[model samples]
Target: MKLRTLLIAALLAMPAAVTHAAEPIEGNWKTASGATAAIAKCGGGFCITLKTGKHAGKRIGQMNGAGTDYSGSITDPETDKTYSGSGTVTGSSLRMKGCVLAVLCKSQTWTRL
Candidate 1:
């Protein structure tokens, strides 16, 4: 009975452990444009905080979903506009893109710092 109880407790704890697992993109990275951003868990998902450049001290983007590839929206501090955003991390490189009005867009490759 004790062995069975232990197995049940382990099973119950598994989901919580997985829930707090870190995303592959979690860390500080430097964008091609020389901006530094820190990506980490936020708002039940992930948020990117601009740690350098013009947007410093801002949460410029957020990814509410999980996976190696993340999709969400980001804000442009320059224009105070929000747009569709997505990112994929490959090794120490992060490819990020954001689209404005579903027509105009921009992309950049960021290096892990």
Candidate 2:
């Protein structure tokens, strides 16, 4: 009886372990505007930064630099606008959508680079 209980407990733990696997954002990505986006884990979540491109003739990069925690608004180089939202990693893709001032302003699909 004790052995059976232990076996069942072990089995239950396996699923939780599997679900804790790293998210899909730990990689490089390409934005729609011919720019690069480097994604990695940040503050127990995920953050994406511009690796290369130009915004107002200045080299566009992450506001907090590399490996910084992201919370709140993020600027999109393509549209040149700041969006407020979050993202999720799904099967080699990071889907991010944000609103500008309570309006569903933009969304983007970034492929693994």
Candidate 3:
């Protein structure tokens, strides 16, 4: 009976583990500019930090949302400019966009690392 209870407890914990693993955006990415970035949970949202290249160690973005889409802001480390941004995750790729006044926008596709 104890063995059966242990097995049931382990089974009950599986879904929670799967749910945590389902966050597709929480990982390292290879940016379009040949840089590496890391996205991880920070506070109530997620933070994007540069892990490699010229802008290494810079915190460049913050996003909030669930599932495949997120909205937030992105910063250009070279110019120190911030733009309204959004990100969409599709499989091992993420399409990130930044806009000025929602009119002029630029996007880049970053691949998972």
Q: Highest TM-score, which number?
A: 3
**Candidate 1: tens digits of C-alpha lDDT, residues 1-113:** 99999999999999999998778889999977688999999878888999999889988889865566998998877888889999988889989889977788898899999
Which is superior by lDDT, 1 or 3?
3
Tens digits of lDDT, candidate 2, 1-113: 99999999999999999887654556677766767777656664555667777743332223222222233556756666666755555666756667777676676777887
lDDT value for model 3: 0.95
The lDDT leader among the candidates is 3
Q: How close to the true structure is residue 4 of candidate 1, measured as C-alpha lDDT?
A: 100
Point out where model 1 deviates above 4 Å: 1-21
- Candidate 3 has a TM-score of 0.91
**Collision pairs in model 1:** none
Count of clashing residue pairs in every prediction: 0, 0, 0
Ordered by lDDT, highest first, the candidates read 3, 1, 2
Tens-digit lDDT string for candidate 3 (5-80): 9999999999999876746788999999999999999999999999999999999999999899999999988999
Error of 2 at 99 (Å): 0.5
Point out where model 2 deviates above 4 Å.
1-21, 55-72, 78-81
- What TM-score against the true fold does each predicted structure earn? 0.75, 0.55, 0.91
Q: CA lDDT of 101 in candidate 3?
A: 100
lDDT of 1: 0.88
